[model samples]
Target: MNPLTAKRIAATGSAALKLLMPGLCFVVSSLAAAPVSEVAEQFDRHFEQQLVEHHIPGGVYAVIEGNQIVRVRGVGVRARGGDEPVDPYTVFRIASVSKTFAAGLAAVLAEQGYFSWNDPVVNYVPDFSFRSARYNKALQVEHLLAQTTGVIPNAYDNMIEANVLPDRILPHFRQLDPMCTPGECYGYQNVLFSLIEPIVQQTTQKDYATLMQELIFDPLQMATASVGMEPFMNSANKAMPHVRARGGWYQSTVVPSYYRFAPAAGVNASAMDLSHWVMAQLGHYPEVMPEHLLATITDKRVRTVRDLRRGHWRQFIRDAHYALGWRVYQFGDEELVYHGGWVRGFRADVAYSRDRQVGLVILLNAESNIVSELSTYFWSKVFDAIHIAEAEQFSELHSTEDD
Candidate 1:
């Protein structure tokens, strides 16, 4: 067979295998690989039950298939005891998922020859300095996106939680210590990403927020996505974040940081809006972005710690690596690209397998370590159901031949 024909055959087989395998349990009986709508409904019900059982205030999800959003679902109340309902347009703070967008922005400018990934940080931020002189020379834009910046645990964690003004934190970032030589270990550090914020400003001659709005958000048509905290709070369709206390769910009423850092964790979006975000990852719209740039950002560069599931998760999650702004995970000989976001009382998870041409996105208002575990469980079951249903249907058809 021709090489191109063999590649096509391999991709089709992988997707068919995904549908034929029974996913993690905890789904409705009607769900089968028979139809996409049935699998979507099963996922909706599975998440609804998870919300009430785990005391999650609310959540939303979208499933994308072959460049289109095939299903979007919301469950529970946005706030416990509140009348607000989670919906397609309801926006939530996506925490670190913002990194993916920032990295994408950097890739765009880099492709335009504005700067290369290996460009020294000090090259742009002329005054840039780190704790050690050797570290200063080693730091590069790739270090920021790859989580290789020798910085210790997030430099501005306190300032971010305290809602400190950005101007206060931006100038003093040179005080943090290096954890390892750059490009040696993948210790996640947000302050390292702070470096990219300045580079984007210097290169584009615009703040990272404006650059993102012009380059990514507007182009993707993610109308509801933004990096502003106050505007999100005042929005009519935004979800109220909740936290579980000793007795029940309580509203989290803390003020947000005044300034935005597009490089790290500062994005707010809806499930519907994020579905399109995943579509962009699959190289669906070449006009908005060059195919090569998207491919560069999603390429696997470094391995991760472990998989994020239970009961056979170890087998399914591997070939993990940190790409530009996303985590690439491989399962059962197929690859999936995804990112998870968490800030305070909000959580978001988005994943899509390039091989299968199918993806899922989940957002929740309340924090529970179990929330992600449960969401993964639910989706895995969906994957399994699709496969089992296909097998059963196939068997039934074959049975007629034997008769």
Candidate 2:
């Protein structure tokens, strides 16, 4: 062989000899496996690169499919000026993610005949009278969850400022003054849902958080999930909220609300725990779930919001509706149930498609709208990967068909 050709042959021969050796056989075997480490590296790149681009303080994410946690990672810091890095154990204020829990608790009660979807609001809380008599009686549990109660948007900002408990604000339905007749238009009302917290507690004789623990978290073994205020604040694994202001990120301190409103936004949990919650929602593990309750939670009651942003022809959220807590969307043939939350300096998004057996949870401390798009992109990427994997799997299973 020529000198260059001889050198190439020698190198190849040495590499093959090493691979054939007893110790190196293990390395070869690992290499031949499905490249799990490489997959993890790529997944981390996708998460960390997005955080760096968005200036998100730091956050955690988990991907679950078919009752398995395929990926769990934390990127960035615990807070803006903190030296601590986030970990799998880091807890985040799950914001409207709590809404799902609230809605679930409501479902549990509804299944027991505590309340019905079509039940009048005035029946549960006599003080829930609206300015218009027709709207008052027309307002139902379904309407509250559907965001079609003719309430103004974010009407609870001043409510929180006033230190008013949700029950105290029930009488203020008349103050909303019917922006549109009940069921005629959709406008989200955080305070209205918060009111349901007391109703759930009163009807079930169990606190909202406790009911969630028994019905959802405990059953799913989500040990790190909680709606407690003091416990989360004092937990060693918890991350502090961060908000961008004055051209830099600042640590956010917890602000007290009038009453513990675990309904609208109060739960805190890590990504691993959330992935378990998502997997339960997917219904792959049926024994751990209450079938009727799951049906109640996932079933769409009304198409409340028309999702005006996407336009009519391509409106994936066109038939968008709300069950108890989830905002339901249809993408082509897939039905996606999702929720995004923001409170103080925390933001979170959890979305999963029931048809695809795909679930994604992203929790970040930085206050930004970019989290929503990042979360949606992650879900799409995961589903796309699943589709490809399934296609390859089928092709392998039928490889001899053509022969």
Q: lDDT tens string, model 2, 1-403? A: 2343344335544322111211111111101112333444466677788889888888888777668887888999997767899887798888888888777767767777987878877777777776767677877777776666777777766877576766676667676676877666767777777767767777788887788888778888888998868768878888887877888778888765622677878888999888888888888546555667778787775575445253321222334777668878754224678888888888898988765466778899878776766654454343222222233453464456424
- Candidate 1's clash total is 9
Q: Which RMSD values do the candidates have, in order?
A: 6.2, 13.1
Name the runs in model 1 displaced over 4 angstroms. Answer: 1-36, 153-156, 164-177, 306-315, 378-403
Off by over 4 Å in 2: 1-42, 161-164, 180-184, 285-288, 304-319, 383-403
Query: Tens-digit lDDT track for model 1 on 316-345?
Result: 553567888888765544566777777778
**What 10-residue stretch in candidate 2 is worst by lDDT?**
24-33
Candidate 2 Cα lDDT to native: 0.69
TM-score of each: 0.82, 0.78
